[model samples]
Target: MIRVALVGNAGIGSQDHQNSMYRPAFERHPRFELVDTAEEAEVLSIAVPLAERGTAVADAIRAGKHVLADKPLAATLAEATEIERLAAAHGVVVVPAHHQRFGAALRSAIAAVRAGRVGLPWNVQCDFVVAGGDPAPTGELVNFGLYPVDVLRALLGLEVHRVHATGTPDLVTLLLDHEHGVTSTVVCGRVPALRDVPPGGLAVHRYRISGSHGVLAVDARKPALQVRTTDTFGPVWTGPGTVDVLLDVLAAGIAAGRAALGPHDAVQAQRVIEAAQRSMAVGQPVAIGQPVETGE
Candidate 1:
């Protein structure tokens, strides 16, 4: 069994509570064993807030443990870069927990795209908006907007050339130009998920990819089934299943001594978000992949 240590407790892990998706997923998987401490584990899974993620991963890597951290690996691009640097020095792998990509709807959409159902995708639009989440230093762009940024990058396999963003902490829009001549528009908002729908309500997550042949659209909140518990009524298609897939990926990455999804993805997302913030602040488009001035 692959011995693992789970850190954090509120959102993803139950630090103060006894319930966590990671703990139960590991317990149910035959190939995984949950250890009480990072020192005793072969791998570390971090579900802490972004502020604590860098230090926790660094500590685990210094102790010779692989790390699988929740998204937005660090609050800043420099911090994410430093984390990657530390992992390399320690010869440990670090991967982001971008499990949403493995959702059934997204998976099916990706499959269709790869199967030539959407040929030569040129324009892509995505919206990832949900309500009632804590605010961060970087606002919605980093907190939730990174999802669409990562998705566009993963699907197009292109580098971001430019980014333009406008909006408030609760809502933001981004226009991106990629290296491969593809342009993408992403909209992310923070509105109450449980609020009553207005005239034309928007789904929590939506994607539209237009290609040479056809268009691919997905409504992530469209429940295949629903469950009505005593306390709540919610969709049956929430994230645990994808988290299971992520657990397996982490396990395989640990066994192979390399990360299946390395820090590059997280780094790119951070870079784009940083650029978007800059764009929002300056009221202009920001070119990505530019060399940072050392000011020596």
Candidate 2:
């Protein structure tokens, strides 16, 4: 059994109306035991607010605990690099919660695409808007856009080459150019909390992909696809009914042992978001990991 501790997300404050996405998902789950503090656990599940994210993960690493942190692992690429550095130095695994990789609908869509349903995806579009949730403590691009950014990454399987963004932090639109001549347009927004939707819940979340043969698209599908990365996670679908599919990925990773912690989607998402911010500031398309020919 993997011993775990919670660093934040005690109240399930905002974003996604279910408590199961947080600490509640582990209450009776097998091979997983929750402890009272970080010192007592093998891993730290961090869902803290955006500002405290870096500190929380760093502390967890300093304590020799692995980390499963929520999105936007850090506000900027620099901070993300520092976290990576610290994790490497401390010899701990840190996996960011870019859970779209595990969702059933997106996976189905991806499977179809790979099966030649959409032959060589040419263009993509996605929009993610969070209508309410404590007024969003950070920029719309970082806090809300991370999901769609990750979705785009999963669909394209390529790193963003460049980014162009417009509109205020309250409502922003991004144009991302990826490797191999593929591109994705993204929109991220924030409005007042809706009385109808769950507090801090999503108002509009959507995706579309057009390829050489056909098209692929998706929206929110809460269920996680049952996955076993060779020997990573087992049949998680057989677990408790209340476990959020996203958190299920976390549970499986812990169960798989340290080497099972995989991918750096959060850091990649951070890179794209920061590129978008630079685009917004300079009113130009910013190249990621490449210099934009801004011809001063």
Candidate 3:
């Protein structure tokens, strides 16, 4: 069994609730034993906000423990890179919990693209937005935007070359140029909850990929289940048994002594987001793919 230490479930601020969500998963997993402090566990599951995540992961690494961090890893690309370097120096595994990649629609899309069913993907369009929950738009972007960016990279094997973005954090659009001649356009941000939905229809997440031979599309928010109540109704956003899936991946990665979603991937995703934020701020495109200097 892997002894697990869960870090930062203070549940006080923005993403602190994320840390608490994993408790049930850990409690139920047969292969995991939840410990109170980082010192007692061989692995650490860090679900703190982006700003606090780097410190948490670094602490875990210094304690000679592997880490599974929540998405985005760090608020800035430079910090993500620093975390990667630290993990490397310590010879510990550190990974992001990009649960969206394990979703059925994206998984099928990847399989089709790799099987040449979509022929060589040249252009992709993605929209992932949700109702804002009392945070700055940029923070929400950093929190959620990393999912699609990671998915695009995994599917196309492309690295971001440039990013152009506009609008506030509540609503923004991005044009991303990648290697391998692939391009992606993303429009994502939080907005006020829309009215007139039957409860489950408010989701804004969608994607379309065009290749030489075919096109792949996914409505990530497409409701799979709906519940009716006296006063409200809504769809369940999570996939069936996805918690189990994530648990399985975590257990396997721990057992194998590796990270399924490593720090390099986190940095790559953060680079696109940081570039986009910069692009919007300066009203110009930001170039990417250059090596960053993370001074020790």
Q: RMSD of each candidate?
A: 4.3, 8.2, 2.8
Q: Candidate 2's residue-wise lDDT over 53-156, tens digit each? A: 77777778888888877666765676676777777777777877666555566666767766778899989988788776665546666667777888788777
Which candidate wins on TM-score? 3
> Candidate 2: which stretches are off by over 4 Å?
9-20, 88-91, 192-195, 221-243, 255-263, 290-296
**Candidate 3 residue-wise lDDT, 99-160, digit = tens:** 66666667777778878888889999998777635555345567577888888887787899
CA-lDDT, candidates in order = 0.74, 0.70, 0.76
Candidate 1 lands at a TM-score of 0.85
Model 1, span 116-221: residue lDDT tens: 7889889889988766534445566667777778877766778798999998867899999987688999888767555333211344687898999999888766
Off by over 4 Å in 1: 10-20, 133-138, 193-203, 226-234, 238-240, 291-296
* Models sorted by lDDT, best on top: 3, 1, 2
Minimum summed lDDT over a 10-residue window in model 3 is located at 194-203
Which scores better on lDDT, 1 or 3? 3
Best by lDDT: 3
Between candidates 1 and 2, the TM-score winner:
1
Winner on TM-score (2 vs 3): 3
- How does model 2 fare in lDDT? 0.70
